[model samples]
Target: MSAQLFVVATPIGHLDDMTFRAVEVLKSVAVIAAEDTRQSIQLLRHFNIITPLTACHDHNENMVIDQLIGRLKNGENIALVSDAGTPLISDPGFKLVRAAQEHGIRVTPVPGACAAIAALSSVGLPSDRFSFEGFLPSKSSQRLLQLEKLKDETQTLIFYEAPHRILASVKDMAQVFGADRPVGFAREITKTFETIKKMTLAELVSLIERDHNQQKGEIVLVIGGAAKEVDLDQLKLDQLLTRLLEDLSVKAASQLAADLSGVKKKIAYQRALELTAEKEQDKLDRDLN
Candidate 1:
């Protein structure tokens, strides 16, 4: 009989969030695979858990998976944990779990805290349908491009960001998703300094700039979904087309407007033509009248 693999979840920040079952699983496991041995040690010490821990972070995951599978085959129970939260979520351990299943070993989840879910639940954003975008690209250009791709995504977006990059990320999100888009910034979840603020992208940018201290801590950002409808009057449409035409040709302007406003391209094209004709006629009418 092969040993079982326990996918355990640890506290995101508050130690009390650590479940009783998770502690038991950690103590009973023959060996524990942790993303960071040093970080996991503190948690173990707090709970007086003496189980041996081995490093299985991104650097050594591929190499360690084989050894972990062998241990499970030998009927040695194992527990996998990240520095915080659940294993295999923006952490290392998927390969070992997959290998265990292939070898007919049982893999059980001891569910508990998750930063994304915790933030989303409390943020009061659209929880019905949401997409988790674990982390944005480090480079500014790449991050902007990534945000552009998701600009029109209807489902709410959740992102994990480091303290150092949170402000820049929020700025880029505002640029791509519009400054008025609602966003939730949850920082240092479950800790004494824990804060979750709901505001528009523009407001958040100003808030971060106003207080330098707001930039410190693990950040979970939740952006509201794309608008389902856009109300544009003739004047607004004319202004939009005029701005778009500055950079794009007439056909391109129509296409770009349709994409940005979620209006049909054919209709936008016709409107663009009408606007042009109206401008030309207005010029003629002014000359005649």
Candidate 2:
């Protein structure tokens, strides 16, 4: 095979979820850059894939990418995989992919299973319009601030949370989105002890508290969003607009603000125009002074 970088997706829980193409690529590739060599070895052993795995995680990706790129340029096919699910989906590989693209190396995707999509597919939520907010902030305060920003979102919300912090995260969600918001929780999906349940956020919290085992393992939370246009705080709206305005145009910022804060786009558009005018006025005043 010519030199190329393959982005591969592996199983989240069930081994069978690993696709045939993924196994072939893992076997045929010259090198497998795994997020965790030790973990990837287990999967390799299961499939009898003798390919050697090299470490490629967030901390070392930048330092070691040049070496991998050199190997790829020399006609070696390399596959990038995470510990579970898809790489770069709340996982590492962003830097590597960008580097490969920048260097004009062929990048291919060998897709299989993804936890977020798997969980969302089964959950009875409106998937047509949804946002994947993977892995919320680790700290409670930051998590709450993020939840507050997303409180008024109208589309279904998806989140991947760790076991230790699942309870705490759920509590924050309940507080920020209210107790009655409909949500679904999928735990250890596709595994022997897999469980998928849906209920109000309050009830889900109670369930997790009552059953300690439910707190363990991989988790995907699908939350239903605000049913109608929400009354968002002007300060919060402005704060969101300001941050979004940094990279996006006024029209795009307004639309995104509406999607995130559950405000009508037309209203957000007006607000964006006003914010731009204020910025210009402030600049003009400074110039005059």
Candidate 3:
């Protein structure tokens, strides 16, 4: 029988958030595939775990997948972990998991802290329907283009951003989705400096700029969806009636405005009747000319 592959989740910030099962899996696995050996060392040291770890980040993932598979074929259980959060979520390890499955190995998840979920749970935004946009493009033009594509998206949008780029990203969102769009910003989740604030896109931009301290730490931005558009023709009809009441009779104005604005004649005629008495004497004076 082939050995199993375990995909483990590491704490995003707080070490205490690590689950009991996750620790056990990490301790018992024959070898651990880590994104960064240095970061994983600190995590392992906290729990006093001495399991040997090997690097398997984006740079070396393709080269190491076959080797990890070989170990699994020899009845060795392995655990895959990213520097933080869940493996394969904006991280490496998919190839290894797929290879294990192909060789008839069982793949199990040891879930724990995930930054995206942590932010969503407390951001005070609509949770029923939402979309996760992991990270925007680094370039300003590219990022704006990306935002434009999602301008019409009706679902709540979630995004991950680095501290250095948070201000620019928020500004771009404000530009594309209107300044008054509601937004939530979660920073340094699970850590001592954790902060989550809800405000309009413009307000958020000003807040971040005012407080230099707010610019640090990992960021998760949640923005409300677009608002519905009003019917332009309906608005034009009302404007037309108000203008025509000055010179033309109410009945004549209603008929002309209804044809021009494509509004129902009956409704326009009823509104014209309301204005008839107020301007009846004026209509008679205009008719004499």
The parts of candidate 1 lying over 4 Å away from their true place are 230-289
True-vs-predicted CA distance for residue 273, candidate 3, Å: 35
Better of 2 and 3 by lDDT: 2
**Candidate 2 local lDDT, 70-131, one digit each (tens):** 99888999999999999999999999999999989999998888889988998788899999
Candidate 2: clashing residue pairs, number? 0
TM agreement with the true structure for every prediction: 0.79, 0.78, 0.78
lDDT of 1 at 282: 96
Question: How many residue pairs collide in each prediction?
Answer: 0, 0, 0
**Where is model 3 more than 4 Å wrong at Cα?**
228-289
Q: For residues 1-289, could you state the per-residue lDDT of candidate 1 as single tens digits?
A: 7589999999999999999999999999999999999999999999999999999888998898889888988889999999999888777888888888888899999999999999999998999999999999999999999999999998999999988998899999999999999999999999989999999999999999999989998889999999876555656777898888767777999998888877789988998888778878999999998
**Tens-digit lDDT track for model 3 on 1-289?**
6578999999999999999999999899999999999999999999999999999999998899889989988999999999999988778998888888898889999988888888888989888898989999998999999999999887888998988998999999999999999998999999999999889999999999999888998888988877757668656776789788778877889998888877888988887776666567788889999
Ranking by TM-score: 1, 2, 3
Which prediction has more favorable lDDT, 1 or 3? Answer: 1
Note the Cα lDDT for every prediction shown.
0.91, 0.94, 0.89
